[model samples]
Target: MENKAINSAYQYAFIGAGNMAQAMMAGLIRQGLAPARIIASTKTVASSEKLTASFGVKAVQDNSLCLDADTIILAVKPQVLKAVLNEIDRQKLQEKLVITVIAGIPAAFYYDLIGSRLRLVRLMPNTPSLIEAGMTGAFAGENCSADDRETAKTLLQGIGQCLWVQTEQGIDYVNAISGSGPAYFYYFIQCIAKKGEALGLSYEDAETLAIQTALGTSQLCLEQSDGNPERLQSLIDQVTSKGGTTIEAIDSFKRNNLSAIVDEAIQACYDRALAIGETYTK
Candidate 1:
């Protein structure tokens, strides 16, 4: 944990004091960003008070106070983001750098809402962000300057790995992949544990085995990987014998068109993200 501060000059305002905001604020503070430079504004006084007490940052119930901050981060849910935006006076935001983490919303949508150009960044971060091991995909609006992108990266890096893409559509793809990926892994782990229990193992023992195996495999991949996809596949191949049980399982997956099924699932998720954006835009 490096204690070096990032862009310490700018004042940061988070519009929602929920788990995602708390996770990001915790990471920033852990990395030595001054708490006094940040403020969180929740819809309720009680929620604002609780966040202030927990994080030692300024908290307010009024969303308009965000206008005074140098950077504004919209952390509200997608369903309510429009209401929050409508509440704000757009004239006050003309010069502000706005970053949004509301899932499925596009930078273009925000641009249309404001009816003017300003620095905006649309980001998609996953559940893993709570542990500071998250992957965030970001896309800066066309009018955003290089410095604006760098600022967005610096803050996002405090919490996890960050990537900037050339196109806004890239963030939608990220929403389908990394954004929903943890749930897929969890479901797979659940299925494995259930099968183990069917084989006479106690539920707890089966879960332990399933989770440990998943964890061990991830660790092994991390150790052997040089940032190459082929390296991971090679490691998997090493443990799969030509006619062993591992091969049997591989064959079964292939017979069931597992790859196609997974691809379709990801495509469906991506389609939904696009649809959500359209819904908000309308």
Candidate 2:
């Protein structure tokens, strides 16, 4: 990649202006993009006002006026997408790369909705985006040019990590992993916190301990991860002495089939994502 591929075409018009959009816009602005270059539009006048005041970006009430933005982001809820995109003619929504962070809907849906030949990038980004630590998985439509995908990658990278997949189905896989993975980790920590509380720790201490453990584990993975993850797990197992507390805990988890349970839960998420796309057209 050349230095010229840095960043291009500001004037991003965020259609939803909701929490995710705000977080992404925040990440972009934090990366040195000017606030004057952003345009956020939401259905609620108050939302528009709040964003404009908070970010110093231009705001608009209607989708029609949001067209002034060079790159258009469809950030509304999945349920309202049909009605929202219905309001804007497909022909007019063309030219610029249309990126959708909304979950469940495939990139091709946007392409088909806006008529084929329009550039589209569909992304599945989690709530962590609010803090700029988000992990996002993006996929480009067949019609999307390489430049358009790179632009989308550059824009999304401002907030968090991103990786592209050849098939849009990868977004559903992403929905199972990083997108929904955060909540899974949180739920696990929540249970751990509760367990700590049962062991006589104060509620705050229990929560803190559980969260710190999770954070430290994640950081370890980030810092020491090699191509093979089982090696690290083996190292962990070695550190956890034989017939020790760690072994006891590991035995309990294995007895309860924790791995299978987590796998099944992820499959449930993946199935749900596919089902949503199947029903969208109906």
lDDT of prediction 2: 0.83
For residues 1-282, what per-residue lDDT tens digits would candidate 2 score against the true structure? 422233545668888988889888887787778888888877787877888889999888878777877789989988898898888756778877789988898666776678777888889888887777898988888888877877787678767788788898898999899998888988889999998999999979999999998888878878777858797887577658887888888888899999999889999999999999888756
Tens digits of per-residue lDDT, candidate 1, 54-73, equal: 88899998899888898899
Once fitted onto the true fold, the runs of candidate 2 whose alpha carbons sit more than 4 angstroms away are 1-9
The root-mean-square deviation over C-alpha atoms between each candidate and the true structure, in angstroms, is: 2.0, 1.8
For all candidates in order, the CA lDDT equals 0.86, 0.83
Candidate 2's clash total is 0
Best by TM-score: 2
